[model samples]
Target: PAAALDTLARSLPVSPAGSAVAIAQDRAREKAHFVQCGVPVAPHAVIETAAQLAAVPADLLPGILKTARMGYDGKGQVRVATPAELAGAWEQLGRVPCVLEKMLPLAHECSVIVARGRDGTVVHLPVQRNLHRDGILAVTEVYEGNLPPAQTSQALAAAKSVADGLNYVGVLCVEFFVLQEGTLVVNEIAPRPHNSGHYSQNACDVSQFELQVRCMTGLPLVQPRLHSPAIMLNLLGDLWFTGDQPVAPTPPAWDAVLALPGCHLHLYGKVEAKRGRKMGHLNITGTTPEAVRTTALQAAALLGIAPF
Candidate 1:
């Protein structure tokens, strides 16, 4: 799907100025583009060949080897604990064009969804705290109280900065890494609705999808406002598997999950589920973080989701 999206996007009529090259489509290009726009990012090296991998500097050791494109949910990536692992990583990733990024200590991960009109007007969603398992998003907690005011301000400014720099005309999402020392670095940018913003459908005055429609159709952009504290759990295909095998998965007990208060369910309607596939999500809204977590935990147990 990632490859398909890229091909489809590239086939459309594009701007000669490179504005159509959305950073979200390619990690290597995104990092370079962010740097060109004066945004801070993790230190990394881009290598396009096995020779480059063999010559990688020792300092970037304990780094991650990532493909430049079509990598998502932690797929097409490998972790190298030392310089010696670089060659092995290159071999592991099939000697593709890639980035070797020093793994930084992260305090947490968060994402900000920014909507910009064709006229340059912009607005952002409430910052959301995210939890991931095996490179796939597991949960997103959102509310004004979920994120510290200062960090929220920083994340919003950073997201908007990239959107403005690209002269982006639709909903754009920026995933940020909050280091242990409290600095924020851009992880990547997405040109459309993101998993982290799914809670907005039930918890915000304006969802990212709605804003995207408005942006693309020349309508005025509306500032999104959070209506509740919410938590969203991504339902991946692993839930359908029996044990670790790919056998037909036991259908999740939908009735038990829906019985929870303020719990909303969304299924993608795909006929077959396979490993790492995104099937749907559960969004739980409540008056407080504790309440959101409590309700979401109940639904997770029913849906067979791993605990956050």
Candidate 2:
């Protein structure tokens, strides 16, 4: 109900103004906004009719078709490897409005979180290196050297430009795909604090949630500082299931996980366990990046998360 929320925001003190929310709610508008900000995005085409579908460029084949709205966590998307697959994919999506994005050779993914104030001030967190499973965020790593200095700078600048272009007045997360050739292209934007920024809770002096509050309450926005190297593993409900032929959900060994140095667990208290459901996250912090990585891997092992 982004549109409904946007309407409510017009009469309320919304952290993100309705205008920004409206843009982010629609892929067509979001991509247009990114281009208007001079940020690079993958080649794509909008398809809402048979004529438009017929007109799609051949170069955009081997692309992913994504619905224009209400799709997240890998939902409402289909991969089409050829022009012939376009119609079937679109039909499978119920003929909804969609965009076809040319698939790129991705080497990695990363994101930047920016907090912008009504006064036009923008401050950002360190770029986060991310890994996804089945199109859902699985892990996020933040620290010095997690990404090359140049790539980090590029991501930060592009994020700032997008926020400033929107005149956005809240925390915004800009996700990007790092091509094998080292080129960075904007993927999409989250209008509020995002999953990839979860590491900020334990690693930063000022977390993204605090930044949102500051923006909404008219408090001064302080640039967040990362005090420790951190890695965040998304806790999916799949973790609650244990052993072969288990009859019921069993809680993960939180005690064992917490025994490791610098491991912090945050559970959402989800009432049920279901595969692929985001239940919470584990944040690992340490004095050194190496120590954090080692501890994080150990925690992952205990939780059955694959090594990254």
User: TM-score of each candidate?
Assistant: 0.91, 0.97
Error of 1 at 65 (Å): 0.6
- Residue-level lDDT of model 1, residues 184-270, one tens digit each, is 888987777899999999999999889888887778888988988999999988788758654766668888888889998989999
Question: What digit string (tens of lDDT, one per residue) describes model 2 on residues 249-275?
Answer: 888899999999999898888899888
List all candidate RMSDs to the true structure.
2.9, 1.3
lDDT of each: 0.83, 0.93
Best by TM-score: 2
Candidate 1, residue 270: how far the Cα is off, in Å? 0.7
Q: Report the CA-based lDDT of candidate 1 relative to the real structure.
A: 0.83
* Residue 88 displacement in candidate 2 (angstroms): 0.6
* Predicted structure 2: clash tally: 0
